[model samples]
Target: MNCYECVQQGRSEVAVAVCYVCGAAVCVDHVRAESKLLRGPASPGKVIRDWPARQLTCPVCRAAEESP
Candidate 1:
């Protein structure tokens, strides 16, 4: 599929990733990599300190999540 961000700029590049939050198709250039600490189904503090984590995000979601 075409990239959501590239389409906005009148370009059409192949989508390399999908935004986890918005499900928007994005190309490598539009993709934002982030580290997300995940919690397991086990009791709160019982989970591993560095369990499965991190994911790709889109520009829009990244901006909304950025610190002020």
Candidate 2:
């Protein structure tokens, strides 16, 4: 089977569910998600950044990260 997101690579034997936000076709050994609060400097105003945890992401997802 092919990955629903990538539609290019064959699915792994233990493919994991994809993340709705990033559309990453993660495998059982690569799937991971978590919430984090990032605190920035106080000079420009303290900023709290909530983001998803990293995992063994696919090439497409990696590309997205690089672009952003």
Candidate 3:
């Protein structure tokens, strides 16, 4: 698939990943990676915090998220 952002700018760059939030295809230049901690069940009363997982999003979604 081609990058949504690149298409807007009249470029046809190959998409590397899809945005996790809005499902927009994005290339390396348009992809935003955000690390988030994942919580999982460990024991009966304990929760484990795993390593931060990467979440990809388009620039539009990222900007809206940061705004409010």
Candidate 4:
């Protein structure tokens, strides 16, 4: 699987986002805002970091945390 956020394909543009939980790059689809307003009820906004760690994250992992 490929990163869903920025261009993280095989050393192309450099992985813009990397999943904190999985330690993988996240492209547009994988990366998401951590704010409730921006992400809605599904996903909340996380603290924006300076690097990929803050940008990418595993949706499955995040969803597990969201579950009650």
Candidate 5:
């Protein structure tokens, strides 16, 4: 699919990822990625490490998330 924001600005760009918040297809220029730390479940003698998770968002949704 094509980038929604790019289409709004009259540009044709391929979408790289979908926004997790609003489910909008976004290009690299319009996509925002936030890193999330994952915690594992409690277990006996289990070696757990911090896993990095990524959350994709569009410019509009990112702005909303940043707002108080």
Candidate 6:
């Protein structure tokens, strides 16, 4: 897909990441890196485990939105 921001800027650029919140495709220069928590299944008596994970988001969505 094409970069949304680049389209606005009157240029056609290849997308490197898609926004997790809005699903807008964006180029590397328009993407922001964010971390998400991943949960692992555990027994009821045991504590749930979580690990940091990565998600790519567009600049606009990254500013005012969250992934579900």
lDDT of 5 by residue, 15-47 (tens): 999999899999999998899998887688998
| Candidate 1 C-alpha lDDT tens digits along 1-68 | 99999999999899999999999999999998877787656676684455767699999999988958
TM-score of each: 0.80, 0.33, 0.85, 0.42, 0.82, 0.79
Residues 16-63, candidate 6, lDDT per residue (tens digit)? 988888999999899999788999999989999999999888888776
The TM-score measured for candidate 6 stands at 0.79
Q: What tens-digit string does per-residue lDDT give for candidate 3 at 25-58?
A: 9999999888898877689777676877889999
lDDT of each: 0.88, 0.53, 0.92, 0.53, 0.95, 0.90
Quote the lDDT for 59 in model 5.
Answer: 96
Task: For candidate 5, give the lDDT of residue 28.
Answer: 97
**How many clashes does each candidate structure show, in the order listed?**
0, 0, 0, 12, 0, 0
Off by over 4 Å in 4: 4-15, 35-55
In model 1, pairs of residues that clash are none
* RMSD (CA, Å), each prediction: 2.5, 6.2, 1.7, 11.3, 1.8, 3.2
Ordered from best to worst TM-score, the candidate numbers read: 3, 5, 1, 6, 4, 2
Q: Show the colliding residue pairs in model 3.
A: none
Which candidate has the top score in TM-score?
A: 3
Candidates by lDDT, descending order: 5, 3, 6, 1, 4, 2
Clashes of 2: 0
Off by over 4 Å in 3: none
TM-score of 4: 0.42
Q: Which residue runs of candidate 5 sit more than 4 Å off their true CA positions?
A: 42-50
Question: Which candidate do you rate higher for lDDT, 5 or 6?
Answer: 5
